[model samples]
Target: MTCVSCRTGLDHCHGTVLLHVDGGAECTEPDCADAVLARHALVVDCDSIEGGCACEVTAERLAHAS
Candidate 1:
């Protein structure tokens, strides 16, 4: 899916899926929980990275749990 605001297609984003909850209210659909987040502003780690910022997993990680 893509952001209705930014229109940035995250369809091809190849990372774990997770949720975006706020307070007692959920931010989005159950699909929102399908994304895996980094839990930090800009910090992440992968099992097998090729050649990228190990901590720069923003786009993917930010897809949820921000």
Candidate 2:
């Protein structure tokens, strides 16, 4: 599947897909998250990644660490 915003394949998109913690929106990319946070001053949470995506495993680990 592709990212709704970027049209990039989720499996190939760079950066982590994060959800805005304030119920704003899901970020299409990690850099997108940073940009949104910087621009709008909002905090975000990492959304569950696709199971077959390479980032899926690392995302879980990071989630647990935080």
Candidate 3:
């Protein structure tokens, strides 16, 4: 998948996760948010990190989700 911030193709980006609060689902890649929002879902980063792309927070949420 391509990064939402960088447009880089990533084969290992699945290590991240984004949670759509109202939709009760999570997206593992940057592009995943597109689908969640398309479903009229509400999502948040839900992760706190010092410096990185917003998508980087997915790493934290992914660990928690699993």
Candidate 4:
């Protein structure tokens, strides 16, 4: 599926999908979320399935050590 706002393919959106509370979906690409917001849409949630991006995991581990 493609993002409703940015039209980015699901596979190439870096696994970040922004969900509108009312309806619709978009990728988290640069300005993509802003585009959705410009339409007066509320992004109440998001799905991050980018398992390959370990930024979050590494941050968590470092935080725990601190």
Candidate number achieving the greatest lDDT relative to the actual structure? 4
**Candidate 3 CA-lDDT value:** 0.44
Candidates 1 and 3 compared by lDDT, better number = 3
Better of 2 and 4 by lDDT: 4
Q: Write the per-residue lDDT of candidate 2 for residues 1-66, one digit (tens) a residue.
A: 644544643323344335533344444554553444433333345444444434455666778999
TM-score of 3: 0.21
Q: Can you write out model 3's per-residue Cα lDDT over 9-29, one digit (the tens) per residue? A: 322333334443333445545
Q: By descending lDDT, how would the candidates be arranged?
A: 4, 2, 3, 1
For all predicted structures, in order, the TM-scores are 0.17, 0.23, 0.21, 0.27
Rank ordering of all candidates by TM-score, starting from the highest: 4, 2, 3, 1
> Could you list the CA RMSD of all candidates, in the order they appear?
14.5, 10.9, 12.2, 10.0
Candidate 1: pairs in clash: 16-36, 17-34, 17-35, 17-36, 18-33, 18-34, 18-35, 18-36, 19-33
Give Cα-based local distance difference scores for all models.
0.35, 0.46, 0.44, 0.47
Q: How many residue pairs clash in each candidate?
A: 9, 0, 0, 0
Off by over 4 Å in 4: 1-47, 50-52
| Cα displacement (Å) at residue 23, model 2 | 16
Model 2 residue 6 lDDT score: 45
Over 17-64, each residue of candidate 4 has an lDDT whose tens digit, in order, gives 556433456655665444344453344343344443345455567789
Question: How many backbone clashes can be found in candidate 1?
Answer: 9
Worst ten-residue run, lDDT, model 4?
8-17
